[model samples]
Target: MQDITFKHTLPVQLRFNDIDALGHVNNSVYFTFYDLGKARYFEEVKRSPINWNDADLVIANVNANFLSPVFMSESIAVQTATLSIGNKSLKVVQRIINTDTKEVKATCETILVGFDVATSSAKEISVEWKEAISFYEGRELCK
Candidate 1:
């Protein structure tokens, strides 16, 4: 895997309950970190208020690979980036890393699709959204 250069990074605080009996952060908790990263990323990129409950996008798929265990004692961060944009969906990649040593603990990629709430169906990626993401990423995205 290539080392990803992330434009956005968010510090993640681990909770005591996040640890399993094995003395490491539970795998499921990482998704929450990624979600925070995604939210922050969008908040910054969109440059406007986002009502998550009324957001027009929905996560279609998520995949992650755990490289190592995360200990509660370590300071951690989640890095996020927009990989590409398609007709109705876009790809986001993220990684959880040890902030002190820069070791990546896990990597994840997700596909988010534009959704119509009232119609209850998929929708085309909005032009406004594409421009916002592309401007923030500093590059033209795939169609």
Candidate 2:
């Protein structure tokens, strides 16, 4: 925990469809929010040259921890950071928190793997990708 260093933040609003019968945002909605956060992180923070489809990386694994329920009425912001980078995979940690009261709604850590677009197999994490991520994280990352 200890508030992982956040590299990017994007505000999100819950839609009507995001809510379940219990009046809380459904579990699947977190994925969308995190995806947006990831996109924004790469675009604005990392400023990478790769697009989602053209990138050499792909999500290989994910582990999410839901601390509290998010409501449609509250304002939330998704925080993203590079958790770790490996030979063929990178780990990113994200958090969605209420902006007004600063309450954590959800947390997710995802592992993205580098792959050959044509061959569709895992490849080494590119040096450019590693440098881009490190620059955004604002510190030396754990190898």
Candidate 3:
């Protein structure tokens, strides 16, 4: 894996309901944290809120690795970074870590594809979106 310097980080609040009978956060709950991280990253990087009703990006695939158990008492945060941008898709990586100890608890990689909801098909990513990401990442993502 390539070393990634995450520029976006969001603190996650754990709810009691997130814990399973095993006294740790359920595996399913980790996905929710990753989702939240992605949302915030886009909003911040784009410098505006996303209108879900007219959103053009959709997740194509996701892969996650759970490195350690997250206890409810742990102070955790999610960090996100864009790995690369293609003509029609972008690769994103996110990790959840303990705020105090900085131990990574879980990591996720996702591919988001640009889609035209009206046509129900994939579309090329917009230049504006690409520029926004490139500027926020502090590096050229387009190849």
Candidate 4:
């Protein structure tokens, strides 16, 4: 595995509905947290709000690992970083960590593919999008 330095983090608020019968956060809810992190990361990186009507990126794959249970009382945040970029897709990695102890509770990797909504087909990622992400990551990502 390559070393990843997360440049974006969003604190997540715990809600009562997030807890399951086991008194910990539900496994399914972790994806929601990751989604929130991704949304904020892109917004900050692009310096603008995303327009869903013109959105060209869609999730192609996702893999998650639940490392530990998160209690309702714990302070947690999600960290996100771009792992790599390809012609039509980019890979991202995220992790949920306890703010106090810095222990990771869950981790996820996702691949997002460029899509042409009008034609309903895959498309090459735009150069502008690539440049914005590369600038934010402080490294060259295009490959």
TM-score of each: 0.96, 0.92, 0.98, 0.97
- Model 2 TM-score, 2 decimals: 0.92
Candidate 3 residue lDDT tens string, 1-143: 46899999999999999999999999999999999999999999888999888888999999999999999999999999999999999999999999999999999999999999899899998898899999999999986
Deviation in Å, model 1, residue 84 alpha carbon? 0.3
- lDDT string, candidate 2, 73-132, tens digits: 899999988878888888888999999998888899889888899898999988877887
How far off is residue 41 in model 1, in Å? 0.8
Ranked by TM-score, the better of candidates 1 and 3 is 3
Better of 1 and 2 by TM-score: 1
Error of 1 at 44 (Å): 0.7
Tens digits of per-residue lDDT for model 4 on 60-126? Answer: 9999999999999999999999888999999999999999999989999999999999999999989
Q: State the local distance difference test value for candidate 1.
A: 0.91
C-alpha lDDT of all candidate models, in order: 0.91, 0.84, 0.94, 0.94
All candidates in order of TM-score, best leading: 3, 4, 1, 2
Cα lDDT tens digits for candidate 1, 1-143: 46556889999998999999999999999999999999999999998768877788899999999999999899999999988999999999999989999998999999999998889799988988899999998989866
Better of 2 and 3 by lDDT: 3
Error in Å for residue 10 of model 3: 0.3
How much does each candidate deviate from the true structure in C-alpha RMSD? 1.1, 1.5, 0.7, 0.8
**Regions of model 4 farther than 4 Å from truth:** none
lDDT rank order: 4, 3, 1, 2
